[model samples]
Target: MKIKNLIPGLLVLFSPLALAHPGHGGDHGFESGILHPLTGVDHLSVMISVGILAALFGGRSRWQMPLSFIALMIVGGILGVSGLVIPGVELYIALSVVVMGLLLWRSVQISHQWVTVLVMAFAVFHGMAHGAEMPFNSHALAYFSGFVLSTFLLHLSGIAIGSAVLRFSASGRLVKALGAVVAMLGGSFLLS
Candidate 1:
């Protein structure tokens, strides 16, 4: 069958992701934490887009941006675990995907300072989501560490993909298209 024929099936696979976070009754640990981000399309998109943006910016932003995000994310997680509520965390998390996708699509360049600020802004929400949903019986440190590691890996993957894509002569269009699809996903979720 052609690729077009498989689109509907693939879209169905992603339907449950609209909820973003669902509770778990049993104990969860490092493994569960690691899988949390991967299982949710919202988390995956922003994490990867951050990496792509880092790659696009190059130089100091390559490390500085990701570090800033991770640091702020940890703080967000702490806030979440402490029951300090940030109103509209879920809406903002979904919005992150749309914002990031637009940046990627347009290939916009902002100052390193602005990049750090924007990235950290969204990072908090992601961390909060992970924090708020943490299993009741899980080891806090291990679970947090698992998510941290997972976020790092996802960023790394985005960097690699972005770098590789940039090397190609037709990369701009491909990247732009990717951004559109990502934005659409976030948009659909918001509208739904």
Candidate 2:
């Protein structure tokens, strides 16, 4: 099959498949970690948008930004596991989604280094949440690995979506419209 023909199927696969959060159990481990991002709309939205943001930036950022997010998220996770609290972590996470959505909406092509910094900042909060929410006595390594892997996949999905959209259309209006929708969804998540 031609690569072009596969794009639509891949997009369908990338689309959010779940709408509901899963129930948590004691000793949340690898399974929990994998589900964490999927269950949290805030995290899922921001992670995917970060990927699109990279596409918007269109360069080394396509990889650098996501890697930066993953690396810093580990740092934040460590902090959370250590019980060092950052005030307003949740607020920052939700706000990251809103901010990312706006960046996409604007189709802002920021310097990769700056965008990496911003993504790192946002990732800390996300990682912190993962650490903070981990069930007591869970396999920390397994959980972290699960979430990290899932996060990487989510980023890839976003990248693919962004690339596909960019290729077929000369106009960026569609991307901008997607950004607007993302922004609105983030905003609603923030309000509640």
**Most accurate candidate by lDDT:** 1
| Reference-based lDDT, each prediction | 0.81, 0.80
lDDT of 2 by residue, 1-192 (tens): 899999897555334443223454325688888888888778888899888887767788889889999999988888888888598887788688788877787786556677678889999999998888776767999889988998999999889888887897669898888888778766765666
Error of 2 at 159 (Å): 0.7
- lDDT value, candidate 1, whole model: 0.81
List TM-score per model, in order: 0.89, 0.84
lDDT of 1 by residue, 1-192 (tens): 999999998677557554555643236878778887887788888899888888877888888878888888888888777778599898898898888888788764557677679899999988888888888788889888988999999999888888877888354887888789889878866765
Question: What ranges in model 1 sit over 4 Å off?
Answer: 1-7, 14-19, 23-26
How many clashing residue pairs are found in candidate 2? Answer: 0
Model 2 misplaced regions, further than 4 Å: 1-27
